[model samples]
Target: MATQVTFSEVKNNGLGYWGVLGFFGLLVLGGVFAFLHMHEGHYTTGMNNQVVWGIPHVFAIFLIVAASGAANIATIGTVFGQDVYKPQGRLSLALAGSLLFGGLVVLLLDLGSLGHVIEMAKGALNFKSIFAWNMILYSGFLLIITLYNWTMMDRRKIAKKLYKPLGIVNMAWRFMLTMGTGSIFGFLVARQYYDAAILAPLFIVSSYVFGTAIYSLVLMASFKLTGRDLGDIVLNRLRNSMAVYLVLVLFFEMTRHLTNLYATEHHAVEAYILTGDSIFTSLFWYGQIILGSLVPMFLVWCRFFKNNRLAHVTAAVLAVIGGMIQIYVILIGGQSFPLILFPNAEVSSAFFDGVNNAYTATMSEYLLGIGGVGLAVALVIVGMKGLRLLPTSLADDVIDPLNLEKK
Candidate 1:
């Protein structure tokens, strides 16, 4: 008979844990300071009339989309009946909720005032706006995930019965949340870069890539720190899954760019992003394509690095960096591109019309974005500390009963 897998709270109250806590605490503080500073005046930051959504939005959107993606592990285990993934479902759900909260924090702060956020929360919503719809989606995601976690953690018989059903609901909700986020940009018909239906699916696939990368890294780090038995079977599965997501995201991205290039009206923006002498061009080709997608793919598939833990870690880290750069290119680059206010007509405006908008991220903006990440990590750590979110062992024999039979 296979040994039963047990779950436990993280008990490492050592120097390393405290040090990490302190570091993330500082990051959260920095984000608070940035919000206060920016709240003083929008002029304090790099945002202008042309480029409204700045670096914070990039981070916010990335985390929000990634939150949906991170839940994929739990979805696979419960919805698909994958036993190998079941062990990590608790951690997956916890991480998903934490990431969403962190991302929402940054988003609310960046909206410019506490009062505005309060009013929105108090039911002052414009139903016509996609943003309003997303507010509901985000709230529903948190509530559903919370309840799902309860079902997973509770010992009640009813909870066990509801687990798969809740997982299915959470999976559907996550898809809608991510699609809504992508639609925020896709619905912008005036923007040459974002006016594509492909964005919804593109973001969905991109979430898979980014979320899986982040989850792999966090899982590895947690198991390593806690001295848990994290077997190669789990790591290999995550690595292979990430590789597939990378290919899908790349395909979607290629389709998006190709569709843009095919349209004569979008040629200028395409040239600017793809071939122009700008940071976006470098980030797209070097950061997103080569280092982010291709290199990670090579690392995972190369026989030389097979079963190599360090290689997997490097690939996950690179994927994360590449994912962030990809979001930057999409969110910031899209806004920086000149708007087509007057097609085929000589138009001049004092508000820097007919030219690419200039934007340089301030230190405050970087802090706020980094803070959101720190908050997410911190929340996961705290959740693990208070709850039995991690399996005591994820050894091949433990997760896969077939391994025991073979042995």
Candidate 2:
């Protein structure tokens, strides 16, 4: 059966008008920033030999992880057959796909040579290298999402029958691609993050949490900006899932640290992250643990979290902010903490040094990083407005328009 509509187009038209304007305004600002930097080269940013990966890496990783995560929201309805999630599926796909556009923008800027990236894409790829595999997988993922979206738009009359197989195919591909992303960070045998076999799973799990959190915030913003209600069924469904997701993330987070605590080689790094007399300690304790983890959890824990829309929205916004901080800690902190000891790999210089000499991001690094974020945000806004994600639905309680006209 076809689900025709509820949300009034007149109201949506108004929102769409202003939303599009705001969206493009941001895109223009980001484009200006990007254009100026493109000519300057990556050297315009903070990245250097000491701290090679900076903010761009942080946001790009977050975007990709968020992109993979978006599937969880869509799949629960399509693949797993949970109807409550149905309302949000299309929006989820749009958000995930859109976020990817933002990620690519930052990554392109981060690469010292856009010219080389083009050659690499056209040239041969070694499947053994995670970078090569990621290039292929990301392209494939983008293609699948584009196709999935096109088919959905055309098949609105009977959305399920036409899209079922596509949904399954998309899921399988995303799982592999997400694994590819994790492998990029996970296989770093030279670093503290690599030794634990659990990093891959961690990325996969956290991707969903981050995806939903980001989507939730955008959903609220879109709804408020447009004056629409996403329907109680959709919101309620998402609320419980959000809570469970947070719980799962916290659990894995605890487990990851516990594992490190047990491993002798990784122990020093974990100590530096957890309680070391270093900057990482502030990031972990203040940013990740407190602002990112605890405060949000406490908000979600309140009985009013589900009942009050603002509380729910707040939880999501905080979670997204915290997740970003966590990403920095994982990527920057892990790299900066130094492996301290090399068991399997031989090293010529292992003499008088501590974590003090470990690498850190520089000023150009911060500028480049901020630029990536601007690009991602601009992408999300443009994609949402250009694409028809924000459907004109008043609420789940409203009678179907098709049924109403029949009467």
Candidate 3:
């Protein structure tokens, strides 16, 4: 018989918990200050007409994409009937919701005015705009996730019956949400880097990679600090899953670049990103490819570190860092490449046409991005405290009883 898993709120009310709260609170304050500073004048920031979406977009997009991916755990457990993953459903949903909130907070604040958001909420939306579609998609995601969470937590027979159905809806909504996010760029036909249709699928896969990494890190940390039994079985499963997603992301990335290389029209932008003597090239090769994908792949799959918890943790951290760099390259690097106003003709203009746009992020941008992350993590911590999201234990025997019986 399988061991019945029980859930409980985190019992850690010590200085450690308070310290974490205090630290993230300060970060949130910093983000608010950054927003206020930028509100004084858009001229104070590093953004320009060419590069409007800066570091904050990178962080916001990552959080948003990861939010969709984070819910996959719950989807697998409930929709697919994965017994090992069922106990993790609540935490997964919580994290998904919290991450979305954090990402949206950054995105809204980055707009430079609360009034703009309010106006959008109160005013008419252009149906033709992808941004308008995204507004609907995001709001729908939150609603569906909330409903799914209720089904998971409720013990009534009706709620149990609704679980799988709600899971399916949530899963589909997440895919649409991620795809909508990708389409934001994919629909930008004017930009050299943003016109690819593959971006939709690429973003979907990326969400898997980044989301799983963040979830693993949070799971490990929460279990360790709260003195819960986090088993090798669960960790190993997550490690293997993340490794698979990493490979998919790499494949998609390669395909995207190779497709761009194959096209005559995209040649200039490809050269700029791949071979140019710029930070994008270094970040692509070193930060995204080497450190993010390859290193984590080796760490997670290597037999030497198969059972090493630290190695797994390190891999998760690297994956998150690599994910951020990947987004930066996509958003900033793509915007930095000069737009080809006239194909096959050299055009010069007073607005610095035909030349790469220069942008350097200010401290305010960095603070806002970091603050978004802090908010996401802090929400997770608080959720664990107030709700019975986490299982009492995730021991190998508890999570995988068949293996224990076999042993």
Pitting candidate 1 against candidate 2, the one with the higher lDDT is 1
* Every candidate's CA RMSD: 1.6, 4.5, 1.4
Per-candidate TM-scores read: 0.97, 0.85, 0.97
Clashing pairs in 1: none
Across residues 234-325, which tens digit of lDDT does each residue of candidate 2 receive? Answer: 66556556667767777877898998788787776788788888777898788776777677777777765645677777777777777788
Number of residue pairs clashing in candidate 3, backbone atoms closer than 3 angstroms, sequence gap of 3 or more or interchain: 0
Clashing pairs in 2: 7-392, 7-393, 7-394, 45-364, 45-365, 46-364, 46-365
Report residue 69 deviation for candidate 3 (angstroms): 0.9
Query: Candidates ranked by lDDT, best first?
Result: 1, 3, 2
lDDT of 1 by residue, 313-386 (tens): 99999999999999999998999888887888656688888888889999999899989999999999989999
Whose lDDT is higher: candidate 2's or candidate 3's? 3
- What is each predicted model's overall lDDT from 0 to 1? 0.90, 0.68, 0.90
* Sequence-dependent TM-score of model 1: 0.97
lDDT of 1: 0.90
Worst 10 residues of 2 by lDDT: 398-407
